[model samples]
Target: MYTEDLKVRFYETDALGHVNNTVIPAWFETGRLPVFELFTEQGNLYEVSLIVANLNVDFLRPVYFGEMVTLKTYIARIGKSSFDIGSEVWQSGQLCAKGTTILVNYDHKNGHSVPISEAIKAKLLQQTHPDHPLAS
Candidate 1:
């Protein structure tokens, strides 16, 4: 798993002084970056990157500005050409939200989905996470 930390921005808050629901998805992406980074020795490969096939999010608690948010990312499942990555946002060690991002490998030249390489598959499967979703 990979983790990324972010500070809640003032503008991200709603009238209730809590983070807006829409902002959580962007935060999830921030956390997903490092996981992808592990696959490429040179990060430049991300420019010709995979695309999201699906996204699932669950908001558990309210987040306020000035809170330190940590986003934990890991691969939950790996398929032929797609991978399911899970993430959760935390505020000072308290749970705030959780989600999954499904990315399908794509050929930049062909503009279509393709199978993930064996190197990437082996690397992702080697990672392990505790079974409990809430704990992760």
Candidate 2:
């Protein structure tokens, strides 16, 4: 699992004084950096070849600017050519949001999805939490 600390920026808030809806996805994307890093060799994390098959977010509560937040990211499941990344956003000890981002491994050169490698699977397994909904 990966834990990233972030502050709800002033610009990220809406008129309601809570974080804007758009900010959640951006934070989730930031929380995914570590996972992406593992897929690429050192010093080349930006060169990714995966596609986002789907993304869903459930905002459990409002997050205001200046609040300290923690976004915990973990592997939810591994499939033949895709995997799910689950994340929970916590603010002041409350579960503020939960979501999943589905990504498919792709061979950009060939322009098609590719099966996940065992080595990569094992790496992902390590990043999964025991309480994951899809965990055995």
Candidate 3:
């Protein structure tokens, strides 16, 4: 699993004083950076070969500005040409939000999904979270 530590900014808070619901998704994306690195060459964005297919987020509790949070990201499932990424946001030991995103390996030039290479699959499997529901 990959972990990212972040400080909640005041600008990310809502009128109600808690972090805006939209902010969690962005934080989750940041946590997925390591995964993105796996698909890129020499850290070049132009070499990325994946696209988001779906996303889901569940808010469990309020996250406040000025607090430190940890975003944990991990592989939930891997398929022939697609994979599911699971993420959790925690503040002061509480789970504030959880999310899942499905991404497909894509051939941008051909405009179609392509099978994930076995070498990449091995690397992804190494990062699967032990607490994941499917880990058993």
The best candidate in terms of lDDT: 3
The per-residue C-alpha lDDT of model 3 at residue 127 equals 88
Per-residue lDDT value at 120 in model 1: 82
Q: After superposition, how far is residue 104 of candidate 2 from its true place, in Å?
A: 0.5
- After superposing candidate 1, which stretches have Cα over 4 Å from the reference? 39-41, 132-136
Q: Candidate 3: where is the Cα deviation over 4 Å?
A: 133-136
The TM-scores of all predictions, comma-separated, are 0.85, 0.93, 0.95
Q: Rank order by lDDT, top first? A: 3, 2, 1
**Candidate 2 lowest-lDDT run of ten:** 127-136
Which prediction has more favorable lDDT, 2 or 3?
3
**Relative to the true structure, how large is the alpha-carbon lDDT of every model?**
0.81, 0.87, 0.91
Across 13-130, the per-residue lDDT of candidate 1 in tens digits comes to 9988899999999988877776667556778755646788899999999989987888887788888888888889999779889998888888778888888889988887665356
* lDDT computed for candidate 2: 0.87
List, residue by residue over 1-136, the lDDT tens digit for candidate 3.
Answer: 9988898899999887799998999998888888989997699867989899999999999998878999999999999999999999999999999999998999999999999999999999988998765432
Which digits, one per residue and each the tens of the lDDT, describe model 2 over residues 1-136? 9998897788888888899888898888988888887788764965776789999999999988877999999999899889999988999999999999999998988899999889988898889867766643
Candidate 2 ranges with C-alpha deviation above 4 Å: 133-136
